[model samples]
Target: MEKQVKKKKKKRCSKVKKKMISSLLVLFAILLAVPVVSAQTSLNNNVPSSNSDATLTSEEQKKLDERTIILKEYFLNVEMAKAELDKLKEAQSENVGPRASLVEIDKKIEVAALRVEELKEKLPVGLEKIQTAKESGNVSALSSAADYAITEIQIFWDSTQSKYLAHTAGNFTSTNWKKDRETDPYMTGWRDFGGYDGYSVYSLHYNINIYNPNFQTIHHADHTQYTDWTSTASTYPDARGYAWKYQDKGYQNWPIWMTDWADYNNWRQLGWYFFDFVGGKPSGNASFSASFGHTWASTTINSISYPAGFGWSTNSNRWDKGQSKAFTF
Candidate 1:
């Protein structure tokens, strides 16, 4: 039956797709270990369905399994084509080899992209059919299998994603901070006049190679800033009529190192700054606990002076921090 199905699918698949099928098994094997698709969660991050295998009869379970396998193959076809399309575009942009070679690559890209789009479009048809079966209150066996299939497919997709992104949620790989420290000053103001929310931009650079050549340099703020200021150790927080506080800058910085981005998405940058006040000492310390999915880092600066608020922290306050292991996700 699958032979007949493949024969039919082949007529619609371009030569580019034939090349894909030849390597499909290998790609899927690697996918098991290489987490993929930064857009995976962004595209469809639905929760698992309430329907489960344990609730289904044996025949229903068999049907669900069959549906799951078929759907997985279809999804992988789309993914594989996308990966191919990405590689082709990357190569075309570089204008590698000869002009003739570039032309050929572009044609391949067009073909692969069409395959991706077609596969993606077809995915919803099957899913919607399953939904219709459930909503119609008929075909109890098919409806039961539908819920189980959706849940299984989601699990399968998630498992595939976990392959490359061992550090799930965010796909960027980890890198060390290229130290860019600043000298301590008797700070009394912010780099930017954000009033009580004034802030000085401090950045940690990670010249990262996320293994996947397609991964781009991502610049974003951490989910939350783990910060603590000492009223006893630093200038009086309430003294300035403000309580000490710290937060991400909430925007991208054209930092000095941004130019270095041309080489690699090197310098995965995280923007965090401190702003707050207290009625206490003019100088003390501030600590931070930051995390994104699988990666975590912590830092503390002791030179926090009053009037200047938290000042700026360029390199974990001149000291590098170790990787944080604890993550909620």
Candidate 2:
């Protein structure tokens, strides 16, 4: 009986030792896994996980993307509004007629002002979000915002000049006559020389002939080339037709010639003369003045001679011609 009891106690002690060893092994495994799980969780928080079952929150990402897009659009709208305002100012300055057009431009200005205000409201919040992304080292978000701003500025600059041209009708000119000549047949080519700023220039060609009763050409062809400058103010003499004083140093007087009109019969025949003058620079108190006169000799039949004078004033707008007096014969 004593041997059996001793054997039973030995068996229980062995069994208890085996169970404790198994429990210790299981506890050690769990302790090792805890560190790995902690590291994985920290990595997932900072960057996207590669695990097949892992996923980023789509709702949060979608909201961020949408906000970025809206901000970009708002920037573009602001730039566009600024360009429209510039065009409106240019149109008003160029003497584009029709008072009603200005009213329309005013409306456009109001609309642009409203749009700019709206953009300013959006820019602050959008910029804050972009900055937050950058702080977290999101390179893509930073690049997107910068690219959007650059594109908006470029688009504004490109469109502004085109819109200004459209609004002013390319700067108003009086001569609408269309005829084909050696240089420009379309007559539309006249724009190459018309406008207030010395920037525009053109060349004109004309032919005149006087015939005798015998059908012989009495006055043959006369050809001349003229350089013209247009400007609101005169920088150089001989630019376009504007008020300018002849320079004392390099100034050269253009030769003037009158066409013979005796062959044509009217109480008083009209002859055309060509004069080239450089446009004058603008001055605060500057005014335009022009003067021309004619001299004639006494005829054997009547002994009559006279001199005529003409003059005109300059205005901020149109070039108005002054009254011309006729020379008595």
Candidate 3:
């Protein structure tokens, strides 16, 4: 009985050893499969999306994207500006009046439109270059395209303002000068006047004509003098019952009778001499007197004084020949 029990125990021990070995094999297979599956998942995750992966650093990529967006915005802005300009042109054409700058505006519009179109057409090329620049990490190429796009957009904006000026407003004009002449003088020998009231006249032009020859003579007091009678033997006796040989002798220096000018426009008053003279005569010799006056324009007059009033005359206690004339021009 004891020997039989020992044999059964040995058989059971062998069966248990075989089961343990099988379990070990299954665990080893699971471990090997786990590595392969994990490796495949990692490779799939790392695979490049498109062969066109950018060589730029993260910061460089960000900058390029920013510039590209800005360029696109510029393109859109320019397009809108062009549309507004076109509308303005159409309105200007329909309601036409004195379009003095219309032709110039049209030419400028054409040129600016062409430039805008050209810039717009080149946008695609610039975008492609930008893409390549980002891929190759070529900062210089990206900068070049950015600079050009910015400059073109600025030019378009400036042109739009110029177009607005030419269409809405007129061209700049210089202020001009104007002149006036006054030819009617109140009296003979009086001068005419000329005046300007605008921009200063750097140059002068004149056309003067004289016709209808006519002349006139008039008495004018040039100058005057007075002298009292003296009790000397050299004095002439009273001839005409006057205390002195000559009561009062009037002397004319300039021609008292003057002729009228046919046509005279020289109205500047270079200089003049006029008189308001008063004199007294004691018992002396004969007396002489004269007066002179000058005038130019409407409000200018000149006078000079020598001897013209009266004091004690040989006959009359007081004598006078001083006179003033009222004139205008």
Candidate 4:
């Protein structure tokens, strides 16, 4: 049964990813390059799956519904962003507005679109476990399987950038991390980079996937990755990032953090993340200031003394950025 669940999870994640990608193509076509003849553009309203399974409790189903609505909003936002981008392009060409203002709007649109896509990817991946349990027509087991479906997905995103005097260019942390993307619910990938603060962080782990499944339980899967420093010091530094998901079947996030940061004894937890199952909303800003690390070496703020860091940091001037999304299906 577990094997079947894993296999189904793999397939479902792939489908969800493919859909995430395909939607943007249309968004670009209708919103950016093209003109809107009708103000009402078609949107991917992620209606509640019509599947009539008794596997989920009313509470469980409610959580799922909220995520569906969230996705619908994102789809709408993309359409709107596209329209705005189009207008900016037109204004730039016709000299209708200040070039700087148009450029600023264009950057905002890109950030928003990237955020929406990251959330979409984290939501539906590894959902077929619940489906497989439902297919068995066993509501009791499905009750257990409900835990297989994460109720609240929280993400701590990574932002990586670099600066030399007044010039700064980067934000490739997203793309660079993408070089070794893994869809599996359980895996880790590492690459060698420079170290910092006299710590031997020769290699950095860009990806961390937690595939926690037990007899039954539900806990948010939270993830945090770091690129503490660069080989050379700078007024500004670059770091990149991506989103992370989590799970719990008698699992604790602290252990993962402990294991993840075993190599860095003196490092500060620039920021930390802690989540509970009470309930959560899907908005990009929940943990937006997270990322690989920084371009500068200012004594990492948000220091919480030793390995007991959980929750976000109080300081917020760092150039770090990342995105996270929660969902149900």
Candidate 3 global CA lDDT score: 0.24
Q: How accurate locally is residue 259 in candidate 3, as Cα lDDT from 0 to 100?
A: 27
Question: How far does residue 9 in candidate 1 sit from its true spot (Å)?
Answer: 64
Deviation from native of the Cα of residue 237 in model 4, angstroms: 28
Candidate 3 similarity to native, TM-score: 0.19
TM-score of each: 0.28, 0.21, 0.19, 0.19
Separate clash counts for every candidate: 35, 15, 18, 20
lDDT of 3 by residue, 191-252 (tens): 23221100000000111111110111111121011111122101111111111111111122
lDDT of 1 by residue, 1-329 (tens): 99999987787677768888879978888889965533222222111111211244566445444443444344434544554565577577777697888888978988988887787667523343111112223211111111011111110112321211111011122212212122123322112111111111111111111111111112212211111111111221222122223221122234434422111121221211111212221232221122211111333333332234343333332222112111111
RMSD of each: 25.3, 35.3, 50.3, 24.6
**Candidate 1 ranges beyond 4 A from true positions:** 1-54, 129-329
* Candidate lDDT values, in order: 0.29, 0.24, 0.24, 0.27
lDDT of 2 by residue, 140-184 (tens): 111111101111101010121111000000111111111101122
Clashes of 4: 20
Candidate 4, run of 10 with poorest lDDT? 160-169
